[model samples]
Target: MALSTQYADEDSQNVLIAKLDNAKNVSNILKAIHFKESATVFASSMGLKVTVEDSKCVQANAFIQEGIFHEYAVQEDQVTFKINLTVLLECLTIFGSTSAPGVTTNLKMCYGGYGCPLQLVLEEDGVLTECSIKTLEPDEILDFNFCSENVINKIIMKSECLKEAFSELDMSSDILQFLMSPDPPYFRLSTFGDAGSTHSDFPKDSDMIESFSCTQTQTNRYKVSLLKPSVKALGLSTRVSIRTDNRGFLSIQYMIKNEDGQICFVEYYCAPDEDVSDPYS
Candidate 1:
């Protein structure tokens, strides 16, 4: 499948997006219930990116369906990120916020592809963990409140050292504010820690590399060809509008027409230049 690039915000030449949950909500209308993971993964404009506190703080896996970047936070220093598990949420800009400003809104956010990147590393012994959306604050501190000891213990067991050191937190915390990060729970960083464990079900790959963090846009015209990555299983081809300013770097512009509808839109993005071949003359 050809790859398109996903940007962070919407502009004249940016990609488009669609909120996954909203689609399912409207799919059944009266049901108004959220769809399961895959539906959201495949259809989200701006995916509902979240962090998980795994007990095996040793590793994490990326969500194959949504194509988001989910993995361990392996820093260049070779030290694994440790966190205090509490409220784990991704700090992303809601692209088309003009519709429903403060609610738990949904839209189709444009993006590059599934396979994202890794965000952490273990120092000293230099170990790496993989799962979904891995990374944390080295100096972060957290506390569990209004919860049961069993819940805390369960979280602890599940998070392993993550709760103790990986401190799962939001993107705005003082600790997270300065840290680099990843979005999708499953992404393509290095093929090593990515294959994960046989005890787990994350897709395996032996050839992958880390790159710049990508972005998303809001649109309704994207087509899904593969659902094998990120919590957002969305796969956008090199369709839609794109142009480069004479430079080798490529830029894509996604135009979304809502017609008479206020929510529907056009989304698009540019994929890695190296990933795609020259267009047919």
Candidate 2:
């Protein structure tokens, strides 16, 4: 179902509308953050932001900017709602998750404000599928307060290199340690588990190291389980930015390029494992 070209019509209806040429672009991004059942969505003229969280300790966000959509509009300042991510994803890929040689799924999404179900109209090769998913009370998202100004260490690198490190991580380990210093062993990841201790390091001058900055030698341990989900984002990204604040909280941002060559971003914020005592403390 193609949306009306006139913004006045969309605004007068007091509804939010957005249309995308390809549904897979949205499906893929949501899949990366689909570890949870429910997601809180915020829609504005800027774009759509979908957030998933676990125990308020770990949070993941998928951002699909307005630039990626053929038409996007928000009637108010913002529209907020919660949805069953699993059901929404299924509806988005009803036509099929994979793309055929020349077939494309076009999607028209709409929301009629609070207490209204999210409506989706998907058409592919002249075939159409319509879905209306019930929306629930939006959960209160956690405020990480992880500002760049508070970041004590930061590393920018090619995702390919980190992808290898994450893939080979010792699953037996309950915690993964990140070591960043201004000296040798510039960056290191270590895991201690039933088998043994394993460490992977990246040199500051290595080609894979796009940029590295560390105010001081600092090491922090994070729950491996909390970080494992981030691999999904790492796999889809071309480059990644890793940062840790003075409190030792970890932030990993992935730069993903969509099928249309538009840049989208997915990020994960994880609280440091409290069981692992801070050596510096």
Candidate 3:
């Protein structure tokens, strides 16, 4: 590709792979679709600034020491961010005008020539609580500095709800909550033993992606077998995602429950490639 022709960041492609890998569950097929879309959206949002491999993503942890487990001194959960959304919004406003690639636009900016990639900040009691930016959106400084922490927590409501499902092996109870939402993409997830998928009104044959039980081979290691992989590619038809083949890398955290009935978490560290694509998706 020519330099003047412009290219999207290589990391965007990787994130797409990550999304596809996470998209395996039969319940929240849309989340995989959403993850895949984030890459395209990131590309289109950055426009000329976002060239092939221009951007890098970091999943920094909010660490706490062995002696810092006290209630008042608990390590504040933080996902450190260093972002460049200016060029990003420009690309997104052009391509993401429709929701095909999971473009999230502000209602206010929609009429005002579409804003930029937004930085949604939530600060309460002198602590920086949350900073969420729409993956592909116009440049909009939606600085919602909330006075209360409750409102900011709502942003990650899905992560919490999904934890409920992940904590238990059976998903029958959790599946009953949000399957029939009249929304375009209702995202949900399952871990290890469950299957998931997405549904779209436009696609007549759209259905749920099935998941299955997986056994842990070792700490933080798992394997599941399937004939056809559940997710998409890292680049445009260049590579595919696999379960054991690729080391999973997540921008977010994975919720897990232990045998002791307590909540635990895992972050995607890495993945192999499409050749190792696992049916677990």
Could you say which candidate leads in TM-score?
A: 2
Question: Lowest summed-lDDT stretch of 10 residues in model 3?
Answer: 18-27
Error of 2 at 237 (Å): 0.7
Candidate 2 lDDT: 0.89
Candidate 1 lDDT tens digits, 1-281? 22122222222232222224232222221111111121122223232222222121111112212322121111122222322222111212212224343233232332222333122111112222212333333322122121222211000011122122212222121111011123332221111112331111111121221122322211111111110111121111111222222222222222112221322112112222233222210
Name the TM-score of candidate 3: 0.19
CA-lDDT, candidates in order: 0.21, 0.89, 0.23
Q: Per-candidate RMSD vs. true structure? A: 25.1, 2.7, 21.9
Preferred candidate (lDDT higher): 1 or 2: 2
Clashing pairs in 2: none
Error of 3 at 257 (Å): 17
Q: Give the alpha carbon lDDT tens digit for every residue of 91-205 in model 2.
A: 9999775657878899989888999899898999888888999999998899999998999999999999998887677856889999999998989999987777788999999
lDDT of 3 by residue, 13-41 (tens): 22111111111111111122222112222
Better of 2 and 3 by lDDT: 2
Which of the two, 1 or 3, has more lDDT? 3
